[model samples]
Target: MTTRARPAIAAMAYHQGAFVPFAEAGLPLTTQALQYGTGVFEGIRAHTCADGGKLVLFRVRDHYERFLRSCRLLRIETGHTVDELVEITCELLRRNGTTADTYLRPLGYKLALLPGTRPGVGLSGVSDALSITGFPMGAYTPPGGIRCTVSSWVRPRSAAIPIHAKVTGGYVNNALAADEARAAGYDDAILLDDRGRVCEASTANVFAARSGRLLTPPATADLLPGITRDTVLALAADLGIETAEHELDVSDLRCADEVFLTGTGIGITPVNEVSGHPIGAGEPGPIARSLAHHYARTIRGGGDVRHHHWLTSVRIDQG
Candidate 1:
């Protein structure tokens, strides 16, 4: 959690544009997404690939595909197809390669929405805005397991807002919980549903393993249907590990043999404790390490072949 602060961003790519300095990756203040969180986005990881540092994006196709789905759901007119988004993302990374751990974000926002006569931002226009930014980031480390505290803030009820969408505004919930956790002297926070069922970490999707079986919250449980979460589940299935998608409460975490969180930035990381209780002796369990290793291989190109559909190669010859 410590480093020499670097420039915020070196370069960025807006729709149909590339190699624009970060400063130029701006929009009018009246842009719909800027006025109201009306767009969706996806977080992708481009790891150092092959012997030549090719920077292959793990599951780039799937990420862009979901981004397309999100745009459709939001009624945004995305001018490009999924394949075009993939091409642009790869090109952006090739141009702005960073030395440290990095993350890629592509935001699809409503560019033309206007404020209604009531003085409130509304979905008056349907055109979308997409921008790609690649930056360096890392997470707080735990020597044995990440220690987390329950958050005082509850997740937004799905009936109020579609909690599943990766809208930038939805992260206000995460920000509030994370701030509470940090002030509570913890590395992260675990949020509960309106009904008090355990949801997920502030930003990362969560999973638990016990008695050789894995369990995680269902998509309907007010959690994002996370791409990395799905990939981890599939990897476990390939290894003959049984996984169950169900709603779990705090008691499950306190008694689980292991707990791990996954996301685009860090892949899979072990969480050894929750609310100050040790999870299976406070060390990363076999399931956690196994999934982590397999995930690393699959992302870095050495996992089971039957599941390679989730991966997208970066060897695209743009000539």
Candidate 2:
């Protein structure tokens, strides 16, 4: 049984508008976000290139843009512009002095309630706070492929919760689905919508290769439209591979020639089986391999020149 890999976080963290020792970064027991799960966060990755020892942040601005949007949904004010957030991330990386593949988590959340305001369950009249933390992490999923199960927990509709944003409270649904899959001896969970349409995996977007084309659920399928998912679409277009966004169900996953997932954490991971049924030949297929290779190079500061704009370079100096 393959277990989830854990990352070693750096000693320092940016907390509450100041950089501090990770041990010193803490919230009060009565903090609203801690109590109510009224927080938003983004998962960002920075890759270290072998050629020049440069650490490049992938789609940092885009991540923060989505971060701010998620914050807005919860009325959590980050008080930082996209450019400012990017700069803070770069500065934090420099301070941490980590020269490896790193994962960043920027959290914006509700803090304590206002003095005159009474809170029972609300979004208004709460203080807001922001914290950014980094972890030294690399690709952890099996490149060969992984087994998955169709989760029994259906994804909550957007009407009930905004599925597009990475709101902290909204992840309980994903956690339940993932736990159910892992407990059943599967690597991850593929959740379906209330209408039985394939929503997405626990933490990543779904993609299936069929007839030499890539098919994924549309943004309307109550799934988080990941930045990595968008990147794959553009890269596929560059490679002349056809792509489509539509609804998919359990049968579609079982019938596809290849199944894979894309996200900051998983990157491009092939899915070999779904609920004990083999996907295609039950192995990682060629198209997935090709895109994974291309994605690796693209993030590490290689690949086509046009795609370089997606990376924000940070130079690391030896001490």
Highest TM-score: give the candidate number.
2
Model 2 weakest lDDT span, ten residues long: 1-10
Which regions in candidate 1 have their CA more than 4 angstroms from the true location?
1-8, 15-18, 97-101, 112-119, 137-143, 315-319
Q: TM-score of each candidate?
A: 0.89, 0.98
List, residue by residue over 1-319, the lDDT tens digit for candidate 1: 2122463554556543455877777787877777788888888876655443455577888888888877777777667888888888767765665534457888888776443434466655445667888786544354355777889899988887778878777888999998887777676888999888888898888898999899999988888878899998898988899999988888998889998888786578788778788888798999988898888778766677776666555552323
For model 1 the TM-score comes to: 0.89
- lDDT string for model 2 (1-319, tens) is 3587677878889999999988899989998888888999999999997476779999999999999999888988888999999999998898888788999999999899898888678899889999999999988898899999999999999999999999999999999999999999999999998889999999999999899989999987799999999999999999999999988989999999999999999999999999999999999999999999999999988888899899999887658
| Alpha-carbon RMSD to native, per candidate | 3.1, 0.9
